[model samples]
Target: MFRVFKTCHLFKQNKIFTRRMAAVNLKSLSEDKIYEFLNSFDTVLTDCDGVLWMDMTPIENSPEVMNKFHDHGRQTFYITNNSTKTREEFLAKCSKLNFHATKNNILCTSYLAACYLQDLGFKKKVYVVGSEGVSKELEQVGIDHCGVGPDTIKPGVPYKTFERDPDVGAVIVGFDEHFSYPKLLKAASYLSDENVHFVGTNTDERFPMDGNIVVPGTGSLVRCVETCAERKAVIVGKPDTYISKAIIKRFNINPKRTLMIGDRCNTDILLGTRCGFQTLLVLSGVTSLTEVNTWKQSNSQDELDLLPDYYVDKLGDLLPYLEKFKPTNASATMLKFFSKSLRVSMAHMLANKENYERFATQRSNNSLLAVTYSLSYIRIDSKLCNQSHVTSANPSIIVPIRPDITEYEFLFTGNHTMAASNLKSLSEEELKRFVNSFDVVLSDCDGVLWVENEPIPGSPEVVRRLKLIGKKFFYVTNNNTKTRAEFLEKCEKLQYQAKLEEMMCTSYLVAAYLKEKKFNKKVYIVGKEAIGKELNAVGIEYIGLGPDPLVGDSLGMIENFNPDPDVGAVVVGFDDQISYPKIAKAATYVQNPDVHFIGTNCDNQRPSPNSNIFPGSGCMLRVIEAAANRKAVLLGKPEPYISQTIISKYGLNPERTLMIGDKGDTDILLGKRCGFKTLLVLSGVTSLKDLEKWKRSEDKEERDLVPDYYTDKLSDLLPMLSNS
Candidate 1:
């Protein structure tokens, strides 16, 4: 059946042939081989869009080939990632295109979404970010839903005034032309509750379109919601195992005996390979023969999995093969003979397995060799097969390692080869040169200057000495729980020299931002009294300062919600009394596209006594961000706002300024981003171990957290600069 030609001249001479390349040209096989390939499978699953028809036009002879499969008693199923149509609509299209299909045979994503929820025993309403097809499918399953059509943002109507439906407990993302900010807001708001379920129909980034025109797919919308909600969705379409699970549960088909025919390798071929089905790639759709060949050459397992077992120029090309293998009374006897011959050949090969393995190992060490048969394919590449026991003649292939170096030491040495230098390791002369390199110093408060009410030993003295040496010092803290004056008072209490103008608290930064914008509207506060006081200093009216706990159920709260129409900005900071009502109100106000949303800081946690972890303002800000489905303008350390303000106001050269702190992510990263010299002290949040971790991190952001220099504590610098 597999006609092995002495000279491979029938195909293109320029193309290199390899036994590992599984995408065999179906036309290259003999007539008997084609018949055996066709008879190997009893069930067929085919993609609809590009294989059967492209939009409305059917490919030539494709319908006849598919219909012939049904005629041959093969169970046929139409699977698609397109969520824009219902099963009934798909069936109608199939009928018009001359492809015989019933509702049971169609498996569109919209219908699958409904089935997914139904299987979960979901009784609550669904918040749909899709089209009428999805809503219609939900209707068929007796599921309540909303948000199908255009829900445009109205002029002058604040999003805070919009009421939330109490019954909506799930959000489903699919393709929708009317994907607006309002829909994203509602969907994210519902998904903010951890109890709410989230589902995505598919993750195809875009649709296949002609010419240079590119249309975004449902994946774009799904990603947007996922980003705002800060959660992942359960995908129910191709490439995911959910569709196969559904098919297995409903039909109980044998994966080994099933044939998957598709045009796309990423979704179709990948799904088939994952499900243990024989894959046939049609070149008429999204994939091409050149792309298949490229995948065959790749060493990556992911790329290798994309290669199909067989490929043809088009689905219509299979018509000739099917016609030649038409059923007859002699077909059964021929199939029996073919099966008997395969068993006998396999048994014979097994008898000489030891000799074959020895030869394979010898050949693998010399060169890459593969022997593919019609029934089974085996590749003998030493690089891929892990035959470590086989000796090679080439001595260069063996890599020697130093016995003295531990694995951890080797890895750490490589990872930290270009990491930050230790400031304490510098000589007294070098330390003096480093001290004189910068004229201005920006210091963080909590971790660097002091921890809570107690100052780190000798830190105050170091600050005083730096100032005495003519260095311009400023206190920059992300703590928004206190006003600038209160911070200055604390600095004085801790024996640190500071002035009113030298303090740069986040509360002051928020007030300054609004004042510079010349904003005249009232501010909605989701923080403590310090923010309100700062706004008062700038002559800005503010509300929502104290406790505003939830009263009754969420439904009643929404019904009686009365948003302040005059409010124009929502400011988020640290709140000791953060409540559901405050978060809900802030989210609602920020939803209005015109309203400014500001976050004081993004610190996840703060240092506390007795080893207690205290949640910071970042936690509260994320809650509001998730509910509003929008990012807030950050004004804390590492965000550039503080550095930009200081540079603009004081006319300090960034290259000549030094930033000293005890946190790498905030303090040191801020200095790095602003082009300031960074010095990390281990007297507070960050330690020497944290620095080592950052130096070994593969993430650029984490690596950037490494400071220009590091020390055990702020006091360590005092001994280095004693003479100076």
Candidate 2:
């Protein structure tokens, strides 16, 4: 929310200063201030869905307030993040609801997406992972597209056998109730090509619906595609500035005088803030007053931008306020209010003993002073008292008349929390202390020691040095593509000394888990030969190791399909030859209450150095889960199974154990979940940008991803070790 202020005189010892008020309640303002506010803006941009109407129902007197805007000759535009409807459809809905909207006034994401592509002169067809609204808008702009309706997995046709359309040059993602496994596969496959443009309609996580039922929105589908594709899409809706650009291009309006109204803060209010528009938040939708207050106290500038200039219970509440201010008498009301001498009685009263004590008592909780004077208010945050002077007469009263103090000096203060740790900058003594503090080291294989088949520079030397220092090292990996022995061989080839007993691969873990359960039934596999080899090494019987391609139609395959009566567990890992038939078979077997479902890991995609994305086992696992309507028992990093096994087997103290990896979601999160100290190396999946985001995130899950220590790479530790 942008900070907005009406000019107010601050008379202190014949000195004056201007200050802004933010997140104010409009109804609390005096009649003159309200009249001034009404006359301030000529253009009004309001969000639909939650502000004007919810679904098909109009919010109380909202239509009256909007229609009044038209009566007063204020230009109105309906802006929405909803991508499910075209501009024509939106205009019709407006007409039906009596909001007095024209087709030109509607700015939905679907229309904006069309405008974006049209402006780019894109000629090729679009492969859409969305609804008909997106496709219809594209068609209106003379752009060809496909993949609008349901695209279910064909019985006889393997997913890999589906040919790529040569004409597809872009992939647009929006709201789609028909989102399925086949659509995900197609979108991911199309996005594999570097030339294909990916555009998402909006990033709204869910709809603002009342009741216990939660409706997932387009953002969920967009993120799913982004994960599987390993590419960030160009967002075309709120908080992206695309729609703002569209509005600016079409209308000649002053941003300073424009009023942007909405219910959601991240999207609607953020958009207004970015465009320098006055923002009004209504509590009839997603964001609440508690959230706004929380954001106000946040140290992050990103979260601060979500604050609105003013808020109300709902948009309809403004109708009564609007009724009081008529165009004929608005000027007279403002003039009459300004003609009177500004009062210092409120400030003078604060100087008295009884009044000061009462004021201090009221503000004791938050240490904040808010004094309302006439039509304006003054807020003095006691937290910013480092440089300011306190009056001798009253020690609690802050003197605001200092010659050097700027108007905004009291408002903006720097008070930051200390960072956890940065390993690269640690002194030699500190480094030695850190090394001696930990007895056991749990290191991720892929990102920490190596990326793919290549070892990271100096990683082997660091491992050798750590081992020489008597640190118990364990190669913890989520990679199920290789057996423990095979992983040990790779470690040896990479010049890192490791034993088979120290290698903790997911494949071996799965086999060990089933073996410990003492089950005699065969295992159904949806992975490569490594899982099969691991099971065989454990003297366990299994089937479905290699590719099981779909050969015929669904009805024919159903008649021929035979469920293995002896199969008691389904193990899923990385399979390069993963097909529709494999997923179908796995889903079918897992549907039975008796059959166990296990997944190697939930790592979305393998970290790649280039544009090409390698879909991880999690992608296959999700596809099978979606088809089966059941969750897999995951066995990997971030899950306590492997960590518990390591702790129990070695009898190691968790407080003295260190977990080091490059992925925050898996490795760092696992360390946090357990009692291990975490060190994040920015050599693989997680980067400095990701670290900063997690550090500032309001979500506890995102904050949990922050590691205790971080460095550019694991190789940087070699210098510290050598010095120590």
Candidate 3:
């Protein structure tokens, strides 16, 4: 809520460190609570046209704030969200405005969308539907333009007639007031076609125009066309995907390091929150002092869905106050707690003001040095895939592309037994024959099946096509935690078919091995309760792992097998709550070689949305492996019995089957050792870099760990199957 007092509280409260604590238990507070909150945000996003100056004239303290950012090396940017101007034009304007913004720092609406479209392999006639300024912006991006000539729309007609092309793959909708009904109808007809993509420049119902409040903006025009076509277009303007991505790329700043600044709470802050950037709101522009709903009961609070990390009358005035700000030791946790209490996203102080002012700080409007999408959700083709797992190491060996690879030169390497990579170079019949030869189809889980819970591009379609063509396939994975049913349910959610009889998992074989041992004594489990549940179904007694009462009297399991010297094996699985005490006990128990020690699987880690990687079952295995200088038996994928468990369960002819996955160490090696064919697709973990590194390795196992075949993705498989 704004206070509209004409900056009357322009004076700082003396004894600011004595500000009342929301939490009373704290002994010392931040140096300056106001400065502390402001420090939470590291970057600022200011609009060029209005806030900087009403179209051009410098507003008060504009240069002061610019100089502050320059002096402190703080991340500051002038985001116009203006589609009318290109990057060069925006930089030129910044130069004219005396901010000295560069082409790399400033972001325009149309340019980002253009770059994304090119990246996405969209080749189509860009039908322009905006003013001459917007048309010029499109021309700067190398777009093959074909659309209505530059003119104002007729008084009654909201659009102009441009001859529609059936081959037009995309229609870029922008602001056009001098419109006609005929143009509107034609655009609607083309946009409604399923193949043609519809992209809007912006959704602002009105923008600052020649000193007048005009209703003629992209939002209103887009609504008219969308209403006519009964569809919504992908908005690519300010506070949208384009500008957010632009800020990411221009700043080279990770989402964690960037912040979005604006005056309007709904449009400005919400974009930052949703785009994974921190947000700051100044009580300067759209939302004024008292109009905000405070009770939290109204629809507007939920509807607007925006809140700033810090609230202030103006953004520029923040610098002068932060010099005296203090901080507490536990301020980090307090910050998250305070944000949750106030229903805001998390943020914290970035750097000291003097540090920013001394060593860095440039005055150009382009404070952002690097930019890109925080989350680049690319929908790639399926094939050579596995469960969604992240890599622990970053690439250090840089492979510079040179004359080694060129179009129509190389194909059918040692791994390309099916000659599928040569499809591009082959004739229609040759491609058909090659596809027909692929009787076996293998699939991975992560990028090909689903990145976590979401399925990859055409996953369902690829599976359906494989099924139709009577291609025998298998879902192979290295993650050995959950049993067969869990993996099947995941597949079902991704709209893929799975038979319980056809299921395979690493945990199943481990459970069977434990049952075979027939140890009559209590088995101390380190993994999930599900493993215990499986063990208990076979009349085995197992105590809980956590701080539950059941584990209270289970100390003797750590000592030598006392009860008739037949204590069962110590089974370790992926336990989310295994404590250090339990590990210390297990380490002591496994000292006797007579007592069998078993672990579920040896996966290094698992992926989660959390900041740190969850140490998987492999961490537990490593602890035991170090204690007993002998390798424990592995019963997971890439292992024989892991695949055999599914075969025994389904009673499938194992010799005729194939294993499909991306990782060479797990998928290809396992399939080759088991007398099964392996198929690799480039949709998941293993990339061209991995292939090059592995293929060039001197190790014998590494040299032999090649897939029988490889393809760019699984979607390519379906087209080949159809042609065959």
Candidate 4:
């Protein structure tokens, strides 16, 4: 028989029995759906500022409350959405509040946001919309910031606007009680109209006062402008995954095994629900038992997704609510929450904090259990694009009918992800099936097809498979500066066939777009002379930036050419004349932001035979883009320009396009971020090993980095497409 250790009040005289009861209570957790959810992870992630504490002090009993987790030997990382303070400051606050914390245990969003901006290549003049704290935080990362003071650009000030000068790139937002209509309107107008960014400090609606009322917080200001602009404010505050991710990055907290405990449902509960943590709502703070009772009574409460797994008056008071907490060691109650009966009740039971958190742990990644209770608008199973089959023994569990919204199914899954090779292995029937399900394909040159100028396994056969089937495909490569004729010739010599039009190298598109821009000045050609020939055809003069760049170099023109103001664009490509003299001159010209700095493409490097290591166009692009402190508009594969070209060439519909690639950074992320369904292939570039590292990261931006579908190789995906 299962031991029901209902309450600790029963064990005052016998410490051993109380210990036994604790174990028994833990056992009951496995048996009871709610207990299992509470025990799913051993780490707790919490946010500061508006979460655990207010401005200078913690919410009542927050320390004694958090001590319960510490006593359990669970890791606790205090994550803050604000960036102004360093770990030292956080630890000081923790000490003051009696919440145990070390520098390592604190993950600050200000720190992470600064790092994120840096990684995305931002280190320029910053326009901040917060107090001094926001500006000071960004400055630590060597980022220059100009605050919202009157001096930067005041009334009656003639400042440079976008059409006149586009250098003022970033606009960061934070809480400011002094936010006026004039200031708010300008921030909204600028952020909405151009590429200027809009980032917020946090999203807390109102801060809790010492009394019953709440004070409007920074989030209210952010929402006001964001609503006016019709743009989603990039939150840098609590409950934002970006902040939660800092714990994973700094302390290596596995999101799969983390829990968040707090009192308020809105802040603590929201963090737990969004950050993929087990949330325990303690009724010792602002939220009350009456509210829960009222929500249940009225049947009008919402955000059922964010409901906590367990409800207790306090951490020390949990022994009473654990009526179902402790059970016999052998009790199988934990598995009960995972039963098919749960899914049916999921839609209704979610609003009940006690019921929702219990079974949420049983949910698999990309499964409904984890997401069903978080964002109401997010369909947990929607990404899979398949009808969910009801589980066994839960025959009465009415599966929710699919909504009328556009349904998107995962294109490849299960065994289909294992057997595939390049897209060509698909039979004619398979080809039609793939084209039916997917509309675009991205192919590479080099090792994917040829190894050091020799055809690899299944070269022409793959090309013919696509040609015969007439599947829309583009030769997407990082190699820029080389013309279409060059890739086509290489294809013919290597026993693979490709047409000039079918070839979509970054080199040709960039050169063509530059030519069309009609800068009509001297081009500082950094790559081979052949690249210069194409530019020359567009009526632009080319000066050699190197010796013997393959396309053309007559009079040591590359090394000796002094850049003239007439030098419209310093076009950097893969250059063999990679001598010190060339690098210095090119770097000098790029630093002048007024000059047009162009790179062939953004690929860092590529592997090959003999020399084995050669710089890709991206490496060259980075050099110029960094010096200018601006993101170069890439004209290559999956970029809108390239996407447009590909779509127009094959008359392919953009919505139907599917980009298949092995690397998540370049291929999957590019395709998906560009609004195409992406299928990550394991055949080249990316691997399972890479995904393992990516998963351990706290970067929330990586969320979109996931592939719509994944496969060991492209060949395996054919069956799924054909079957679909």
- For candidate 4, write residues 1-724 as lDDT tens digits: 0111111111112221111100012223534444555455567776454346756766655676466666666687776654446567778888988887777777665565566677668855666666566666677778887645432224454222312114546667665433433344356445644576677777654444443222344555565456444466677666666666655666786654676765566667667656555566666554666655554334222434345655655554443333334323322443442231112322343334333334433333223212232222234344332233322223432223234323322111111122222344556675555556654566655444554556655545655565555566677765664677888887777776677787877667656777667676677766776667677667778776445221222113333545566766677776644332343345456556655776655554444343222335554444334323345566654356766666666777656777766556666666865677666666555566666545543344554556666656544543434344
Show where candidate 4 strays beyond 4 Å.
1-40, 49-55, 58-61, 64-68, 81-86, 148-165, 212-214, 284-286, 297-301, 313-724
Error of model 1, residue 25, in angstroms:
2.0
Per-model TM-score, in order, reads: 0.52, 0.56, 0.40, 0.40
Candidate 4 clashes: the total is 32
Q: What is the lDDT of residue 350 in candidate 1?
A: 23
Tens-digit lDDT string for candidate 2 (535-645): 998898999987465466433444466778898999988776665456657777887878889999988877664544556778778666755657899989889899998
Model 1, runs deviating above 4 Å: 1-21, 160-163, 327-724
The local distance difference test score of each candidate is 0.76, 0.77, 0.54, 0.54
Better of 2 and 3 by lDDT: 2
C-alpha RMSD values across all candidates = 14.3, 12.4, 24.3, 21.5
Instruction: Superpose all Cα atoms of candidate 2 onto the true structure and report the RMSD in Å to 1 decimal.
Output: 12.4
Task: Report the Cα lDDT for candidate 4.
Answer: 0.54
